[model samples]
Target: MEKNHEFIRYVLPKGKTFSGLTQAQATLIANHINSTARASLNGCTPFELALLLLDRKLLELCHMAWIPADQVTLKPTLLK
Candidate 1:
């Protein structure tokens, strides 16, 4: 909810109505924002942050004693 409000206040033109946006337009706008860097993320975009988190999780799993050592070579397919 707060993210939506921030988008409206900063991204949308003055006096523009949210209802005026088409579904595709709204999604495009949202994707653009998520891909853009923000100060709150210390200059990383939300997408980058998510990928970083995923990488950390993968590392942690690979370090687990029960996990096969060969599995450490596996990488996240989507992010690449």
Candidate 2:
């Protein structure tokens, strides 16, 4: 809380790297949220949440970009 969390609240980052704050402040928030959320879970950190979020988003994007296939091809090997 020495740098950023000294204040009661903060705005989420608008871009990469949790911008517009001090490292100590960012660390404090990360630690608190990790501890609390982890305790509630069996010991999982927010990083796990982030990974799950990324996977879900990727799956959604893939589904959006999916295309119908005209036919299937079975290839044992490619010939030179």
Candidate 3:
């Protein structure tokens, strides 16, 4: 959580204040940061990293449960 707060502060434009910021503006800033390439991701965006991790997690769960492909339908809403 501390890292996230630091990231929010770093991404906010110079001379801008977070005070009274609207939800839309806050989301725009967050999306911008998440999409920007980072050295830690070897030039991949965080969203890409998240999707890769999510896929691995889903596969792991399916294996653990011995779930048959025909018995399960992993819908897009499951990601949310």
| C-alpha TM-scores of all predictions | 0.48, 0.27, 0.49
lDDT of each: 0.50, 0.37, 0.51
Q: lDDT per residue, candidate 2, 1-80, as tens digits?
A: 23233222332432325455575544444434333334444665444555556675763443322112222111111010
Q: Pairs clashing in candidate 2?
A: none
Question: Model 1, range 1-80, lDDT digits (tens) per residue?
Answer: 46646654565656757676666555545444556566788976665665666665663443312222233211222112
Off by over 4 Å in 1: 1-4, 52-80
Candidate 2, RMSD to the unseen true structure: 18.8
Alpha-carbon runs more than 4 Å astray in model 3: 1-15, 55-80
Model 2: how far is 62 from its true place, Å? Answer: 37
For TM-score, candidate 1 versus 2, the one ahead is 1
How displaced is residue 51 in candidate 3, in Å?
1.5
- In the predicted model 3, the residue pairs found to clash are none
**Residue pairs whose backbone atoms clash in candidate 1:** none
**Cα TM-score of candidate 3:** 0.49
